[model samples]
Target chain A: MNPSLHFRPLRPAVAADGATTLDLLITVRSPEHPPMQLKERPGLNLALVIDRSGSMAGSKLSHARKAARFLAGELTERDRLAIVTFDEEVNVLVPSQPVRDPLLFISAINTIHSGGCTALFDGWLAGATQVANQLDPAGLNRVLLLSDGQANEGLTDAEAIAAKVEGLTQRGISTSAFGLGSGFDEDLMGAMAAAGDGTLAQIESPKQLADLYASELQGLASTVGRKVSIGIRAKHGAELVDLLNDLPLTSAGNHQLPNLRYGQELSVGVRLQLPAWMPNQEIASVRLAWDSPDQEGRKTLIEQLTLPVKPEAELEGLEVDPEVAEQLALLRANRERRLAIEELDRGDLRAAMASIEAIDQRLKGLPQSDAITRERRLLAEKKELMTQDRNLSRKRLRRESLRSSLNVWESGDDNV
Target chain B: MADSLSLSTAASLGSDSLYGLEELLALAGERLGEEVTPRTVRLYATEGLIDRPGKDRRRAVYGQRHLLQLLLIRALARRGLSLTAIAPLVTCSDEELGQQLLQLEEPSPSAEQQEALSYLQSLQGERSLSSSPGSSASLLPLLGSPLSSSSASLSPQRSLSTRSAGRSNVASSRWHRFSLAPGVELHLSESASIPPAGKRREAWLARLLERLREQLESES
Candidate 1:
């Protein structure tokens, strides 16, 4: 077991007739007694699916090729890599093979040229197939897709694409999408990453592609856990509304948690609806489980808290955890920003402006972090653009929406 | 683009941000992420789910306040609250309204509800509503699908034991074990499981055992 990993629930005892909110802070504190380092890190089964559409003919294609070549250099012989490039038709440039020959891999990637329409769906499917063929049970399995255009050739529907990505996620194949330039569908890529249990990035300019790829690859190489699932067993009549960063969560029986990396703490804020319950009723119990690659075994970390139901009047005096309150405020602000951007996309400038103003007002009273400050500036800039110009750029809207919804600003990296 | 765009400014009201009913509906629809009709907006106004547009019915104009009100109403409506129940709450202070909104946000279902939904979906996919619940062997694949580990699924070496207080609470105590490696193994026990199945006693036993282990170490 990885003793460093810990699950702490910052739950408050609040009495409400309708609902209450809770937060679970998941942290990885280094243990006092560190374990011996293994001789070798866990292997990775990675598929690089690059789009070679005509839209990517110039800088985008070259930058992607450079990134692929650079990624090959970072992987060892133990890692398995598959390179699949797609235009109007999908082609396997290099099948899944051990990364023993970096020269061969780099040469193969360099041969890919931009042309024709984008077969994004088929390209991703082919890459996933390659990863599946060499699927490492104890290693990280991921399909990293880079697209510069929409899915014009096959599977054009965003929901259909997302569902397929989710299917692969269920089958233990994680996927992350990188949208290059303005033409690619940010919504589709965001949906894929969210459902695929991975992260999404918008490479707004071609120049940033290599750096983004490098950062993502670095994170992927350090993956400590796999198949991480958090199943919430809430007491009956108490429903959970949203998860971390205002991510939409349905009132379902079980939830599959996203993978976590070392040295980072992930916090999930759960909004629970409480029907009037009898005093001393058990509110909820959370179960945390994951597969440990280092231990080469399935590991379980459980932290279950039972809250007693209290009368609404009694709960009024109970103060919420200060940290929980702060996190909730940030999440609500982000959600409002997202909604505002969506309104902008729908051509309702007035509502979008209102949402932006609401976000600005909400942010005013919250604890400001670097991420929050950046978001506020971006929102302000966007608001100014909306006020001055009636014509809103789809690219800017898509990028802003993806950035807010995916919690990308929260990360230390300034450019994603 | 004209149909899609809200170009009409509230000229008489002297504020570009202010809007008429047609524009309000469009803005409300966009903010709510759903189609909000003029009639629905009027209904919301009449029921006080949202504030009335202006003092005069002949020349009414809605501004930022009305837009926010309708948006909040739309949000509350999404949370499964009827307009009548949401009306009084809409007029509260911002902080109070926020607190109420957080309170009204739907909670996630319990573990039992998720299992029932999954089971129903599986049955619907197989077109086997009346088919038998199958055996303990069928449960392994579902568990195995998520993890890339070899022994993550239930194997022959795995053992499930239970000690119940009564038929009503069959999962009062349960034990589960699976061999992780040569000498290492995972042992878990929990008091979590759904209620007894109607007729499929065998299936319930299998599912109960699965729940016990899963609950003991819920996935994150």
Candidate 2:
């Protein structure tokens, strides 16, 4: 199924004699959701990389084990899974195999006990190898690295880890990360997922691990596109100002979008500062590419945005598309949310509050939608939480930040 | 007339935001919550910690920039970082210095704690040892496995709704974060009930001092 893609410029016609800048919103509408898509799922070659460390002694380890067992039970003979657990040492406990018997998977999951220090890099590498070993082109292959971003022993550098994950993603293997509880740096975990073309989530408790796993298993089953990306190249000397997804940019200056879902409405906002161009000129070219989930090979969709340049008077008379305006508001809000979260992390409550209040004040001017209203209300709630308890506020805010930035949650309220 | 606005606000604003030395002292005292004497301000300037205050009509005037720079000098100094170490970090624009002050506020994890938070995360659902069925796949050749393809799942149409997620803050533990490297940290724990910078902060350093204990870890 092909996704419908289009571009909407904030100003349909750029001001030829006025401001030379334009805001373009590229939206890819996925094929509509078919309910029957639930019953049949692509074969999954997945790795569940578990961390059985000393620190994860209580709820963290227990919840993770239960989640692993539950996830193993969910798969069928058609699906293949590999389990790799690590502490000071990395162990491939369950090699990649078909989920034929529940008792065998259960016995393996039950043997997982807390061990020593963290060898995060080596452990993840082990899990990735498992998936890569049993890689199937027609199936979804992923490594769910359960870690807390603490890599003491092996490769502790985040950038290097992210680069490795990205390389593996390019080789048809994706990795997702889940760090149990709050206050842990989601940035590192989130960065890996974003780099690996997968999902990153902050699990609040060991118990939430099972729920998160169930939802993610369902999400994986419904995966329609792998390594979905939007490549926007400038045309006619137009400069790309910003792409507002807060995603890690590729060396070629593009974004790795979340895997496309059935009926995926991927709306990405890009700002373009146009140079002198006549009416009816191509300002930018957008290329959407994804690997077909069921062995259909790599697919690419290209669309050239040819916006008409108008004189200042004509441009002034043009109305902004409501869709473009709405996209601009949400993306702008997302940016402010990031700034606010950064301030909170830096231990500046007043500044964080001030930023949220200032943005909430700014949002009053935009054409308000239910989404914008919720964004303002949520920011206010975060501020309220800060005043009550700084610790709780920080954790809650980080989770909210993850949800907003990634938009990867399968169900339930945004707060979870 | 140009001096009516508060010094720090002026410094954060434009050139029109200048103030007298006394006004700078007062705000610094309030920010640092300690006596910020003119002598100390002058000492900072003499030591080249802050930019030399501008002279408006030969009466030494200061801006918000001077104040932030002053606070940063004191902040870095309080961190026990020598002037040389502080020099490279403080060499930025007023805006960047402001951000740096905010970043410097939080303390880094100590070496021992850093070791604890150092993470090796990957999820393995199976135990291969003493398990014959699952481990047999490890012995199987990779290329020989059948590669059968299937379809993806059906998803519900979704949007960012104002749904309040009810959380269970039970089994709460003091989460620890350790510095793996610069621009990266490993935060273990569900809750980090850190004291507000107010009670323990050095007036101006209050924002950055909250991490002083956290810094106690990484610095150690």
Candidate 3:
């Protein structure tokens, strides 16, 4: 059986104008009903990439090691694991091998000690290679890189490091990035995950590392869908502007989406400037194809939506659909959150406050009571943190911003 | 204005009749033997899976586009595809859809392909019956109206009455069919509290039909 995947392609029927660009939300959700528990899944080949730089020596390193122990204990004998620690150089403490006795790996992880300058890129590259060497095409192959300092030794640029991760992903190895403490480069970690087709997370404190690592592990082990890709071909006179928030879009084209897990609805908001059209004209065509656990061949589903060209007056009279409005509001809120962070970083407290207020206003207008209410409350708490401590505000913003842009559900809201 | 005038008088103007929501539901039952409700039709419209009624809420009028889309929705839903998957097809122009229909109607058969083609046809026959809520395959042949595959193109200008058979199944077994109005029907299972067939049953059925007609009129 092929992956039970379906596409919910949505766009406003009437655009504001021919020259104007409107947002399109293409969401992919597994068609399978909610199972009682994460069904028995295939094994995972995970490489743990840890930063052993001086900055990570104290609380960060201790928590990371604890997280490693928790991970080692969680895996079954069938799963394969690797541990690579780096500072000025990279060292494979435990090579890629089955988790027959996790204690052996945990003890090796305990022996790791902090050393010289940070070599972030080299560390991730070595870990990604290790995972790829034992790549299980049928199983999940991932590299979880945790860093608490900037790359000072080699390949320091974020784009360069992200490009390397992109190459690794193309070869069937994805890299998830975790930024620990304030010293780490949030931009680099976010870029790695966005380009490598994995989740990006910011650990504000060392204590949260264990829970975050456990959650990431749970997400990896419960994978129900893989190699999910969507291609969009706009008819003549239309341009596919962008997949907003720079989703894990591939260099292959802007069409591909990141892999999906059960209960995760990847919502990609696309902006397009469509040309004038007659009534019932096909504006665009979308093809979604995926490979499931039981499927030997890729299953493809194609859909073409017709957008009729109505007069501006008519469009104005038509009521804006509530769902469309809600999605647009979410996108707007995400944009403002990023803007607020940037303003705060520049020390323009007034500008940051304005952006935060905008997010609050946008969330209030959305229809989903539960989702909107929670988001509004989080925004208020985030504002209080911003004025209280700058470091804490920055950390909170980075974590929330990454999750917001990637559309990752909160801990308890995973199945919802 | 002329288009609206023609649409308002379409009932007497033959094939390209502008159907009310009720008329569309009745036609779905007559042609496909499927019990489609007005609510489902409204849903398809809201989801953009079917052409919406032209006028504002007060005097809404559904045309040939809506009729063609409703039928196509039913046809695609029977193939085990979700509505999200089929929503794109609702955007296809009549000409584009005609081409797809042409492709679906004709198959190139080589010696080796014959076996697979037969299997697919048999699967289609079986699936149309089992998939729908209360529809059955046996009653489809009762339409008896000979329809060519080409005659069923989704062109808005073409009347839907000429649509080819074998697209779906009809209602059967442990079922009761009632005529609530001209071209309108009510399909009920035997479990319904319908009186036995006699003078009391006749009176009960008449009253039931009258009440149904009144309800439909009020909603419209």
Candidate 4:
């Protein structure tokens, strides 16, 4: 269960003066070729919760059904699948059962049609219950909720629903949200997915839904760690200024992170104000905790980072790490882009442009990579496209920003 | 050409010569024969086919540049030009734009074609109402289809050329001096400006400036 957890301060050393502030990056990397070493991988017990409201009447329903059928075809006989669809009333079309016959699941999925009001929370609860009933400690137990956002029928508040989702995550049944389109409340869906320790996919169309589903299933199959979270324990004199990732924080103050997929790096930026250092004292430590696959308890990895105390003269000569700078730039880009979208919505174009301009300034001297170049292109493209249509622009900006920050960005962009 | 131009278009191109949406539409209707509507004009502006109207005292208004661009787009659309095909025209100079518009007579759209255009327009209206971001329709360059590519052909080089003018050399003659402590002063060039991106960057810059101040104090 050993994974790489690293803490890298931008500057290798800290000045002894209490006035010196340090910026750092925390990275948790998943093993790239783990399934190759293991004899067997855990099967997925997934609950597919779909919204069949009246709003999903025409092409939306047709494409959703097609996506669902395609997903059913992707599952193996080792996996357990349950189909719980909802309108004003929730119905369990396929009970929790083994995928001995993909045909049966697809047939059941095809029979789904549009109905009345959206009972989103109820539908999700029904799906989470299905996974919990046949809970497998060794397997991946998850609820995949596909919705078009409005949950008018029952328990509609986002904060309340996220709380319930986190409760399910605690019981080893994580929930991921697949928001259908522009109508999908990005903040709500993103919040729920973050709380549940799963992926939040902003599906712009029914066609992309199938591909996103396939990728998500691929992620589930190759997940290295589940219930992954980071704990920040600041040493007595040190102060944690800010965490740049827009992550969900637990009541205990741990940052809930996405479940680790092979080759995925979950990195976040932080700034710390350390008091006068004495010798090589450890100022702060970051610990990673995830569900242990080998045993009943949890797996833990600790990385204590302390800068080499040096005089002010020596500290001034040190250069910032490029990796840390890039991460910081990416993090700043994610946050500012979202703020710029909000500024656009408020009809303040200059402020929106300035918000993005700030990010461009931040990227001025950073070493260029595919990642950095991608950030530059995204910032420019979003600024250009943000004025086209308010609803669509806002939706795309939020989703892309969220996706970029989470490192789940795919090149299959629907660029105009 | 000035006499042929719609709405007493003055030869002098001052920035103050502005037109409202209604005025642009009225002028466009005179030139293009009523094919231009407020929605379409706004759509074209948003799609980057025309320069976005600037705000003058809280009311969005367009300049002569926007007027010329709108007329060019309306004429081309009347000539059965697809928006993606016409994207390059956005970068044309005023002389070239006027020349191009003068050569292509507005093809009289047939009743069937008019019906088709209006139907497509109504469909666009409906889709934008229930707009899904990143759809194929969003990718199309023609019409008011959320032309992400329309922006591609229009904005990047245009904004860059203007930006590159100042970016190449940030030189300013004026500088200001402020005292940090006894016998220590800080000087800043006028062009050394930073936008209020966020508090974090500002705080970081302030810290670095603080270091500069300390260094100066130690030197003194």
True contacts kept of each: 0.00, 0.00, 0.00, 0.00
TM-score of each: 0.58, 0.62, 0.58, 0.63
lDDT of 3 by residue, B1-220 (tens): 7555545544332436566677878887775568999788888878889755655235567766666677767765653335665565556665554443342232344432343234334433543334342243233233221222342332322122112111112211123332222233334433457455577766775775575445545545
- Segments of candidate 2 deviating more than 4 angstroms: A34-39, A387-392, A395-407, A414-416, B1-220
lDDT of the candidates, in the order given: 0.62, 0.67, 0.64, 0.70
Model 3: colliding residue pairs:
B136-B170
lDDT of 2 by residue, B92-189 (tens): 67777787567445455444223212222121222222122223233223212111111012121121011101111222233232332222223334
lDDT for model 4 comes to: 0.70
Model 1 TM-score on chain A: 0.84
The reply for model 3, stretches above 4 Å from the true place, is A1-12, A15-23, A33-39, A236-243, A271-276, A290-299, A307-312, A366-368, A404-416, B1-220
- Write down the DockQ of candidate 2: 0.01
Better TM-score candidate (3, 4): 4
Q: Report the CAPRI category for model 1.
A: incorrect
lDDT of 4 by residue, A1-416 (tens): 36788888889887786566889888888877775457666888898999887667778889989988888888887788888888766777766666766876776777777765667877887677666656677778889999985776545679977876776677677888888867778777877887777877877777798888888888887787888778888895888998887776766778877788778788878889887787778878888988744346778899888778998778878987888888887887777678887888789988987888788777866888888887777677766766665666676667666753343424276643
| lDDT tens digits, residue span A324-354, model 3 | 5576566556656788888998998778877
Q: How well is each residue in A1-416 modelled by candidate 2, as lDDT tens digits? A: 67768988887888676557788888888777745545578788888988776667677777788888999999997887878887756777766667776555677777777765567767887787666656665678889989753765455568877877777777677888887665345667777777777777776556777788887787787677777777888887789988776766666666767887776687888888876677777788889888878656679999988877777778768888887887777777766677887898898889999987887887788877887777778778878988887665665555555553454553354542
Each candidate's clash count: 10, 37, 1, 3
- For each candidate, report its DockQ versus the true two-chain complex: 0.01, 0.01, 0.00, 0.01
